[model samples]
Target: MPCTGQREREMTAVVELEAGGAKLGLMPDVGGSIAFWRCGEMDLLRPVSDPHLIAQHGRAVAGYPLVPFSNRVAGDHFRFEGVDYHLAPSFGGENCAIHGNGWQRRWGLDRLANSSATLTLDHAPTRDLMGQWPFSYRAQLRYDLRENGLSIGILLENTDTRDQPVGMGFHPYFPRHAGLKLGFAASSVWTNGPDHLPALRVPVEGEWSFAHMRDAGQEPIDNCYAGWSGSAFLRWPREGYALTVEGSPELRHLVLFTPPGQPYIGLEPVSNMTDGFNRPIIADSGVRVLAPGQKMEGHIRMTVTRC
Candidate 1:
């Protein structure tokens, strides 16, 4: 079903997908983001309450996809194939390019069903837009709602004339409440420098460890974890529910962001580490170079269960 709402002067529309008691709300016109998701009466994602903020900042919504690359690119520039590529700072007042360009641009609805939808964005070379990336490409996002949870697929193809460096990921914001626990197995975590660029890779230990289910207390965090096991779990004892996150093996990295005092946390599955393009000499950096006409695809599934 289709739903429309207005926030300030900008109007936004949502496409609803339902299966059994699970419902997903998507806004293809707003950065192809997930407006809200619920299973029965329980919210699986943090719902955006401010309409004006939703109209102005799509990334601030529940969930948004990252394409071509994920996380921050230091100095807003990188070198590929002996050519230096520069990107305009997409995030306001930030000197680095964050989360690629997908989450800020509108995606065209390619197909829609009662419980599923497909959206596409063609990044054709343009003077103002496509220059952010050195190559032209097409990105497709498919959202399928199941009886228990939601499944998202991301497909990116290199339509440029030469090879291109690529990476991708998903940013899902879940409700962070008391008695909430996060569990995931990761081998190492990156320590961020003053500018938020990864400065060192250290073993996961102490407060940075998530090897078992434990309450994510008020410790501030905004760092990337490497060597993820492709599986994660979230438990909310107070809400009597839990969610299991599973992603493809290509998503070898995860970024956790727990803003101080915010009622939400970001558990992201990404294909590369932060500033991966700048560290091309590192063999396990997770950056992929795709030749012309090549394509890369990955999927992430979130299943909810009542405790």
Candidate 2:
């Protein structure tokens, strides 16, 4: 990650990495986000067109790491270790906290290289902030750009003295165009209730089935698919390119969110299903509890190929 570009935001440094005609732009200060990823003139990840917008909208960035937990935690609350923790609503309109605090705070640059970079965030339990999580933890994210594609690794360590519930994932936005096809292996899908919590777990069939490569269609999908095979494929017919996404086995759940009429699709490789903390222990809900000083880590790789 030979660094370039001036500070874009308040103390927010923008770094660019290049390898084998592939380029990646990173904003370490902006929740360790990837501003854009491109190979030649084609975009492998959806690029943020306006730099000014990223400061106010971190989710609109090309990609960002999800730490501590993934997705909503019901009414911004969860019980762990016989104690209840309440998190303030992280998003604008949503009543529950979405994603984790990592995306909403700045991360420190740990290391930088020509083709890779590492960012770290250390969260200590404080009177004001700890009320939301009630635990101390350290999160590390590394982005490596290879000749074929990009690989992202996330590590979460429970720095507190007590046990803590943990989940992790990656939210990467990909360009969605007409004639695009998606394929993945998942045994079931999680239906959301009115509050966007997991209402039910249903088998993957009919419109929710993506066993074979097929167009995403017009139906809106904002659900988590359980029993994921840890791999997925997205093909762009109009661009004559395809992207293969593979994740570590720890990432047993896949959350697919294709907002109607949106130009991009979010295929997230997550460690747990929605509201995993509150749900019963199931084979597909990839939730885990880390003891004091314990750490959990996972990786996701994206390879691009010409169709």
Candidate 3:
């Protein structure tokens, strides 16, 4: 959102993809965010009717991406290799940089096909990307329309001459209903402090466990999960449909954000945790250091079916 202190690009045109009975809408200039995803008459990703709303809060659209790194970086600054870097706060945290640079900067439409489109973004330390994330990287978000749903492919390349900490994530919003249920398996949960940084790492159990399908109540849950099964299942009994999210192994973190009384649920597949940079040496933090010319890639697929 603009209140997050990142530059909000003006809304350009939306690129669309249609295959079988599914349709995917993407806004390349608006942080490369997805405006909508629909299967037949059913909205799969909580379609956003107005693009302006997405322009204001790029994350307000159906979904947006987290690139180079994901989640909070703590203090709006981070020191790497004895050098300090300053970043703009996102998600409205005054001192913490949240969600990465991809969701706030405009992305170029590299290639467009009938059922797929690719958006590209190049970040340079000198250019600042409006947030001054100190790294030179290339990110590409590819959206493909499938027969029953869609898939997103993320490719991040380290263009800097030295090693750089890089990771990627996807934030997708799903319509919430009283009869909705979610199922997933995770070995650990990273509890957050009042500031939303990682406070504790605890075993998944009780309310934190989703090993089997359970009602998705109107509860407040904003924690990151680790050791996931690489997938999650969401079903709506009353709606007679189900959705599945599959992620590549590179996506080691799963974040669930369910705010009370909100109409949508944020189910994210990410590569790192909140303030992961702070614990740079901890493998559990999910940070990956890439050498020059090296790249990392991951996939997230969403498939829907009749119940």
Per residue, candidate 3 scores C-alpha lDDT tens digits across 49-102 of 333232235344788888888888878877778877787666542566677878
Candidate 1 lDDT by residue in tens digits, 1-307: 3334345224357789999988898988777889899998788899544322322353346898999899989999999889889987776656778887887778999999999999999897688785567689999999999989899999999999999999999989999989889999999999999999999999999888989889987788999999999999999999899999998988999999988888899899999999999998878788999998999998999999989
Query: Can you give the TM-score per candidate against the true fold?
Result: 0.93, 0.93, 0.92
Clash count of each predicted structure: 0, 2, 1
Whole-model lDDT, model 3: 0.84
TM-score of 2: 0.93
Arrange candidates by TM-score, descending.
1, 2, 3
Model 2, span 110-212: residue lDDT tens: 9999999999999987887774577899999999998679999999999999888889999888888888899999999989988878888889998899998
lDDT values of the candidates?
A: 0.87, 0.85, 0.84
Model 1 spans > 4 angstroms off: 1-11, 48-60
* Candidate 3 residue runs with Cα over 4 Å from true position: 1-10, 47-59, 127-130
User: Could you tell me which residue pairs clash in candidate 3?
Assistant: 76-95
Clashing pairs in 2: 1-113, 1-114
Q: Deviation in angstroms for 165 in model 1?
A: 0.5
